[model samples]
Target: MKRLGRRGFLRMVGAAGLGWLAAACGAPPVPSPSLGSPSTPQAPLEVASPPPPSAIPSPTPTRRPLGNANVPGMYVRYFQPFYPPTREEWRLEVSGLVERPRTFRFEEIRSEMPKVTREARLKCVECWSARRTWGGFTYEALA
Candidate 1:
């Protein structure tokens, strides 16, 4: 998939933030029909209405010790379960119907390639996203 440019990315982020703020502001609760007084003088059921969105206090923002590093949410939804391979045990294999096949260890790639640090947004298909500063080396850097 084609990546979005910084300007387009920032626009999306701003729009999302505005949308969150609008949602947080919330809609006015409609009064229930049963809330009206009965002409027959029936005993009124005291149904407790939930507090307004504004009444529910929001969590205050906290300061992070590590700059631009954001941890993933506590609850994660993944399509498939897979064991993560550690750098010490993992090797990248580059083999295909080609003239030469090559294999590189994780440590080799880390030591040999030029690394890049970038601020990126991790957006889920569910419309949830988080921005963080990521540091990694690209495959192109190996070339």
Candidate 2:
């Protein structure tokens, strides 16, 4: 499978004394549903507790299930099952400090932009760490 670039990370960090809290990946970002601002306080992100050993699913044709793997395919670490958003529904919203906030569709980030492949880890305090070929595009490229 082809790789996709990372999008939306820490953007507005500078000498400006205003100090508006905004986060976009300084290098590559994995923009989720929402990253709230200070005006309306946001609850700390909540994640499910670690899954038991028995919870791990049997390997399918594509995945080995858990731990680091250099090959393609992904493992699900969540306790409950989930369906990731299809390309049509997923969006990356670039808001805050910028003069014009914009929403990027899947194609704009995955196809129109250049892609990069690198080894990276997904560390979570609530669960085990997983590694992958972190495919991401620079945040500045979107502009």
Candidate 3:
């Protein structure tokens, strides 16, 4: 086998890490006949001539323009990672060296806790940076 350099190894590891992260936050796509889902009976394949240039539809803008607040994250996703864990299943537990110990669920926390949003930059060791909007309640808020 050929020897792998540090750069090659790191690249492979980073790709794998991203793949794992994607999987962890992933869910099966909606079953469709086009996708040949196991439950769906697939149609036999047919070779057809390519459509004429005019017959093809031109690509149109289907999404709104990205704004400053729309910074993409490395592990970015608009959907909840769980599928997701129901609001009742996600718990924010507080304990140890606190006056009152309490476990709050997602909805409760979101409804009760004060939320903060600020623009911040995340600098990676790989020598790149990106602005991110951080939103969350603090420990003091929890207290």
Candidate 4:
């Protein structure tokens, strides 16, 4: 048996380490052909054609009533007109526990003072109200 010195032992360890490293980092081996020549081309595979579309049955006709059978001659109205009273016919009366209580026509009130218009909201105690731009005289003016 031969005994290796320190330098020879180090050299042998380094060679074994390099061989293991090479084996771990080596590229994959090329594949080999088993059945035929690698350069030969393969024929394309054939598939059967799909079956023809089936004939669809026609739909049957449905019968329904056209309009209301009970009311035949009924017709709808579209427009309506609104008419207001004339200035001569307009009147306002205030009568209560007061010394200056009086009744006056619209013409007499118009002649007494200038009219004032205002916008106000009338709210109810039940938490519901409507907003409106009112055009009318105040309580003092009416009084």
Q: Write candidate 2's Cα lDDT for 1-143 as tens digits.
A: 55443432223234232343333324566666566633654787778899998999988678554454443455555688888999999999999888779999998787777887887877655444656677788777766
- Models, CA RMSD each: 22.2, 31.4, 24.2, 26.5
| lDDT (tens digit, per residue) of candidate 3 on 94-117 | 989899999998888889989988
lDDT against the true structure, per candidate, is 0.78, 0.67, 0.78, 0.67
Alpha-carbon runs more than 4 Å astray in model 1: 1-75, 79-82, 97-100
Q: How far off is model 2, as Cα RMSD?
A: 31.4
Model 1's alpha-carbon lDDT is 0.78
Q: What would the per-residue lDDT of candidate 4 be over residues 46-132, giving only the tens digit for each residue? A: 787876556454677863333223322324344985587898777667888766777878778777766786755555444444445
TM-score of each: 0.41, 0.40, 0.41, 0.32
Residue 64 shift from truth in candidate 4, angstroms: 40
Point out where model 3 deviates above 4 Å. 1-84
Better-scoring candidate (lDDT), 1 or 4: 1
Worst 10 residues of 1 by lDDT: 65-74
Per-residue lDDT, model 1, residue 50, is 100
Candidate 1: RMSD to truth: 22.2
